[model samples]
Target: MSTLIVPKLDEQPWPTLGPQIAAFIEERAIFGPGSLKGQPARLDADKKAALYRLYEVYPQGHPLQGRRRFKRGSISWRKGLAKTEFMAWVAFAELHPEGPVRCDGFDAHGRPVGRPVNDPYIPMLAVTAEQVEELAYGALSVMCAEGPDAEFFDVSLERIIRLDEYGRADGKAVPLSNNPGARDGARTTFQCFDEPHRLYLPRAKSAHETMVANLEKRVLEDPWGLYVGTAGELGQESIAEGIHEEALAIDRGEIDDPQLFHFHREAGGTYDMSQREQVIEAVREATGPVGEYGPGQFESIAKQWERPSADKAMLERLWLNRWVRSGQQAFDPNAWANNGLPGSIPDGALVTAGFDGARYRDSTAIVITEVSSGRQELWALWERPADVDEWELPLDELRESMAYLFEVMDVWRLYCDPFFLEETVAAWQGRWPKKVYEWRTNVASTVVHAVRAYREAIASGEVHWSQGDPQAADLARHIGAAGRRRTNFVDDDGQPMFMLQKIHPDRKFDAAMAGLLSWEARRDAISSGVTRSRSSKMLVF
Candidate 1:
């Protein structure tokens, strides 16, 4: 929460339509202008106008059907496909609609609260003319279909309001570091992460972190965090991949009670390569082979969008959004989604804690996994000094939290970042230290531990979550795409010391980092691990 600072409401401009679109949106969705008392359809004037314009402007061959998934390669037909524009517009409708939709709320401490505010609205975040309109319409349609009872709240205040040019409220982007009265006039709701794939890089990732953190803080716990985007790039890394992984999990049911919405052109069918030669030979005899085309051509055409042009394997893993396995990793989301949360932990088990620290203005997280019961609980409980205050606090507070966790919760051990608060930690140890064991992680060590812990938890059937908790689910998603650094550091004896490097340039799972530290600490703390049932209830302070 600290390193990932949420900009104030005034930081960005409100999502306002042009004069014509604005008029249309107001007329269709909200109440009609002037003497007109009532209107047809399920919408008010603003809803109607916005939805009408959106439906009217969608381009031919574009994917508009809210079926299982839209066909890909449709963008290729248009000269200048404006997906971003459409998405932006969709985001606007979701946030600014006259009625309500499902949304989350948060307290000043950033803890989630209340039943989700489910309103009948869909928001998009498009960036082009046609896209803006089409996306707007698609979102509105979804809203209308949901009817009056369906409503959701949002955490994104800025996206809800109208913005001027320069990505600012009044044409000037406010400096997040210096602006006051930022969130004065913004709206809030169940947050949507539109087009996550577009932000694959570090800068994009950071922006996403900022946005998501802001929303999380605002929406509180159990709010729906919807992510809509195509798969881009592969590798076990990237935020898009994370979304894809979660969708896969929801599809498979590894996470319980997950409401998954995904659409892909290539998911409906499959092809057999073994019959290719014979089919190709027949095709060759028929059409003279069309140069090098054969039975494989059919398969390729069918799967064109299933993978990307760069890094076929990676693309398959990422864009195709399929599970990419290298070894005997357990808990395939596809498989688990079908099975439900693994009965890994026995009921009434002993649990340990894992904590990850953050640098800059990031969150501090604590993850508890019941060793016997297999129940897993993760909380990004604490925020950084910068998140709440202008400057950073040196060390006293962190040490106090750490000590409290160690003593009160029977937290066997702690996994933590050495660099984030290295000096502060030193100060803590110097002033009033416990003989507590610790694992200081670097990027490389963090990755190893991450893979080990995740694989072990899933493979061992020891990881379970609270059903129907999007907050925990979102944390899981964030953990999925977290990558690690290449090299790590060592101590005086050349022993692996800490995970100092970053996973992605922009994105780092501070929560995951804390989890890693906790995992490592558990190993160091216990002699013979206690039975899972013996672990006490989750401790929260």
Candidate 2:
């Protein structure tokens, strides 16, 4: 059997607390399923390293010693890696009275001894009742079934009860579903968020956001949480992906937040799925220690790969732990990343603005493109806040920003999509006359041409964006989330023209739409012989 070790970040040496937690897990917990079912839970090297890093703390005599360095930690590994089993072990340890205590100092053996927290409350959260039952409750129940730990902690179908000397429940592990009311007021010491990718749907997103916000309150308490799941789809906008992106930003020094820790292991992007050897290597790398934990794993993978109905994207996601985007992605993320320049659009440059608006749920975006160099700028985006239920875009603020842009730059044309903004468009058109034009996006043939032209421009590197601009990154995200769909209209040669559609309902594509409209306006201006010299001064309409 081949052994594959995935590379990870280098950090500080593990404190004695790491090995202590690992010891607790090994001594108390048992495997829930697979080839190792009913056996002692031994920590593999990778799992031990992860636990050590997660539990690492500042050395004694430091002001922040014993306090957790990371408030939240994520494990983004491939499927069939016993992620649930590991999480269940951590959950059991945290629920135990002696787990996650303050370290006084190192002993003669350099081991860190811990002081316990009084009455710790741990919640195992998932998006569905069945998931909560299977992943959290099922694993915990199986681990605590027949041992001395079983007598110490009574395992039930609904919850895990840590009993006192008199047999009364002292501490507990609560299994929570998606209901926000059930999760409202309980103070949680530790939380396990399982399969957060399922929470990306619009209806479930609100609950997930609320739950996370509530967990943030733990900063005043124990302030530790764990997120364990497989890699989510690229454009899914999942909470798991959001956490991973934030961790990446922190890792790159783009942002500063010491409370977040992220760990992800997957195959390289260049690995081709078509080659059998490459596929097997990637799968082995992703499914670390499967030979020991899960016998017949490679045989199962080979069988699945040979099956006629196997989905390549699904295999990439589940086995290789890669983020497989839709086949119809409008722009390759690599191309977009390569096209970013270092500066914003030049001040007072001749520019055309494209406006795409939504009333309540969807986002509104304004994209500006410099006519001389085809550099696109994400001017503004108005999105609803995660916490607010009845939020609406501030039209007055939008109008003020628009007015400022027109006052500062030499505006050549303003193309508005006029969706839920007909009156606003009319007012702007009345003010600027020739400068403001309503662009009909509902027209199939026009949109087809615009999308095709914009896609070609991106592929050809005609579009440039400011590097390190957060708004520009948001624009790229929206563009990446757009996928092509066949339109009713066809071209002259009877070839079907494609229009952009959102990969998921909650994901916004307004920026991509605005870019397309802005590109169309740029093309029109160029074709009409409208030069930058003609628009050297601010608009006087």
Candidate 3:
């Protein structure tokens, strides 16, 4: 099966304490809330191999000899692969009094030996309160309560506190709540974020960031993070996808590696979705031995995929562990992730611009794309504050940003939606009469045609985002929230035309619209032999 094992193995592998740690886990850990609710927990061969990789350390007497080589370890397996349960055991090793979770000294054969951390403070965090009872925390609860090592701790639904000779609390494992107060967990020795894809809520994301920063405080413990989950929906600006991108950057050598090891597995073999047997084989390949024992896991997934109402895209993403976005998302998350090049366009470089305007409830954006390199940058964006009803679109700032773009870059064309700003557009047109045009997004034919061209440009590597800009994350959110919206028009080949739409009514994709307009402007400029402008840079407004 095709797998993504980052930082490809060295000619000689590093020594690890994984075997002893694994033995401890199997002896003390019990199954979490699942089909094997109270059964002894076991790791399949594939998962055990991944565990060895996670624990691989530097050699015996180096400066950081016993410290873990990978401070952050991730396993991206298919659904039904027991990823949550597998990670829960790692948490157990961290929290248990007898667990050999930390490395102390090297063995006679040069293998790292392990020991328990003193006064461990481990938190198994779930994105929401409801998920705490179903995910990693839940599994941990079961293992501590029902396992052979029940005598080692005082287990309760609230928390698991390890006991010493006098029954005093030595270390503890708790399910952190998703509240503002619960996020200040600075005493953490090891933190686990369960199904971080669901961790997109503002408070949840904040909690994660806060917890990550806390990992530095307990340096002596050699603190680490363990993340395990199935593939998540590609967009939604998920925490999972963010880490995935970081691993990719490390793989590309664009950034210094922070000892992150990502084990990403997908069904490897080619298959026809139409063939039922082939579909089952792909599912089996992805799930490995985990699917073998699950109650009808492989057959059930295949049936779901064959259902008339099923989301084939989502099924492919979840069951096959592919990164392609599901739910008719307008842009490919992989494509967008791969296309962000690190640089900025020089001032006076020719570029095309697009504008999408909105009033109080929504957002406004102006995206610019360089004529020569096809790099798009989020020049400006404005959003209304949720608590403030007395807000405006800040047209003055919008106009100023546009003027800056014009003065800095030789804008060849400016395509703008005049909605809620017809007078402003008129004034700008009057100033740069030859360079600006009033492009109405309400026109189905023109808008759809332009949107298709923009999508094609993005997919074909003809357009990309600049990584140097901190505002790229904001633009990524706007782009990620966009799904498909069917238009009344069709393409020249007779396929139905589509425009970007919000996956939810409350979500904002205005930057995507602005990007589409900018790309459309670029398309027109490229066709008319007007890719660049040598005119003197000036903006009257």
Candidate 4:
């Protein structure tokens, strides 16, 4: 393997807490029940580097001294890399009397150490109770089973309590499921969110959001937490991906929140799985020391690849830790990623706007396309608030945004999907009779062609977008979440047609539909010879 492809750490001052933690792990912890069972838990170079970065404390004269540097962090690696084992060790360290202390200074060997907090409570949380039992509790239980560490800590299936008789410095580690009652009074000093990619489901998402919100309330008491997981399949909208995006934003200097430390180790990009050597190399890079701990990972991957009933996309996501689209995805996510540029349409440029509105369950979005350059922009998007039950669309705000778009840009055509916005569309059509049109997306014939044409534009690199726009990012997600659904009906030429449908019922695809409508309107305007300087007078109302 080439060392050039590996990630390099940035320069930082001295006094990192990694060495002390490493010493504790090597001395106290043992390998779980696997190929390396009973062996001392020792980290490799990559993992050790990640640990040092995660526990790095600012220098004494720095502005944020004496504070836990990273309030939230993540370790995204491939499967079978002992991610759960690492998390289990960290959980033990957190609950122990000497874990997670405020750094005072460095020792003779330049090892950072500090004083522990009083009354520490660390929780290992997961989306499902079964997963909590298997990944978090299972690993910790094995580590603290029959060793010197087991005598010092009372390890049980439910929780581990420190047996030390210290002065008001008691601590414990507990396994927590996705329940309001379990997370009710968790004033956590350190918390671990294991396998957060499973939170992509709706029910899991609800629990995960509530748990994270509750955890954030106690940040003042304990600002240190870890989000550890592998890369999820595309369109899942995993909370892990959300944190990963935030870390990328911070790294690019797009946002200024420095308390989030992200350590991601995956294959550089997509690999041609057809080539055996390429697949092996990618898997080897992703699974650092899995062979030493749990052999047969590569063999298992090869078996899965050769199996007739295996899902290739899912295997790529699980084994390679790459974000891959579903098998039925309507568009290639990589092609969409390539078309993102770093500019937006100039103000007052001729444009076509598309509006997609939903009432209670889904989202409402506006997508605008520049007539000349084929550049698409996400104008606005609104989703139902999680706290409300009977949430309604903010039509007034939508109307105001629409008016602002019309006033600022010379809109050639405004196509509105008249789903729950019949009245709004009618008003707009009356106001801008020459420009506004009620576009019905429910018609199979229109939708089939529109979806085909829009995807073709994206595939051909004709659709350009502003890079790093959060709304655009959301659009890409929604597009990825859409699956191609073929209909029984055929076109005039006897060719089968299809439409893009949501992969999951709760996941929204309104933004993608709005983009399609915008592209359709832009095409129509171009065919009708509509130019930027077309001086058509509107009647004053």
Report lDDT per candidate: 0.38, 0.75, 0.79, 0.73
lDDT of 4 by residue, 1-541 (tens): 1122112355655467777777777788777767877788888776776677777776666686545667776888877777888887777666666654557665675555665556667777787667887886677777777645666577777777776664332667778776656566667677788998776666656655655565566544444778888878655677776666566556546555467777766665556777766787777777664453446557656566777787887777678777666666777777887898887887878889998868776789999998878888888998764335788887789889999998888888888889877888999999889789988987887889888788889999998887746678878866776777887767778967788787655567788888889999989987877645444422111
What lDDT does candidate 2 reach at residue 104? Answer: 55
Query: On lDDT, who's better, 1 or 2?
Result: 2
Candidate 1 lDDT at 382 equals: 49
**For model 3, how does the per-residue alpha-carbon lDDT over 1-541 read when each residue is reduced to its tens digit?**
3577787778999888789888988887888886788887788887788888888888977888988898888888887778888888998888888788788888788888889988998877787666876788888888888888888888877788988878899988888756546647467888888877667778777777788888888889988888877667655667777777666556656456567888888886777788888898988887765557657767777888778898897788788987656556787555676689888777888888988867666788888888778888889999764335666798788788888887787888898888888888898999898888988877776777777777777778778899987789778877876788787777778988886776654457888888888888877777777655554553322
The whole-model C-alpha lDDT of candidate 3 against the native structure comes to 0.79
Model 2 TM-score relative to the real fold: 0.70
Candidate 2: residue 239 Cα off by (Å): 5.8
Residue 256 local lDDT, model 1:
52
Could you tell which candidate, 2 or 3, scores higher by TM-score? 2
Root mean square deviation (Cα) for candidate 2: 6.4
Ranking by TM-score: 4, 2, 3, 1
Q: In TM-score terms, which candidate is top?
A: 4
Compare candidates 2 and 4 on lDDT and give the better one: 2
Q: Model 3: how far is 95 from its true place, Å? A: 1.4
Q: For each candidate, what TM-score against the reference? A: 0.40, 0.70, 0.67, 0.72
Rank by lDDT, highest first: 3, 2, 4, 1
Query: Per-residue error at 46 for model 2, in Å?
Result: 4.8
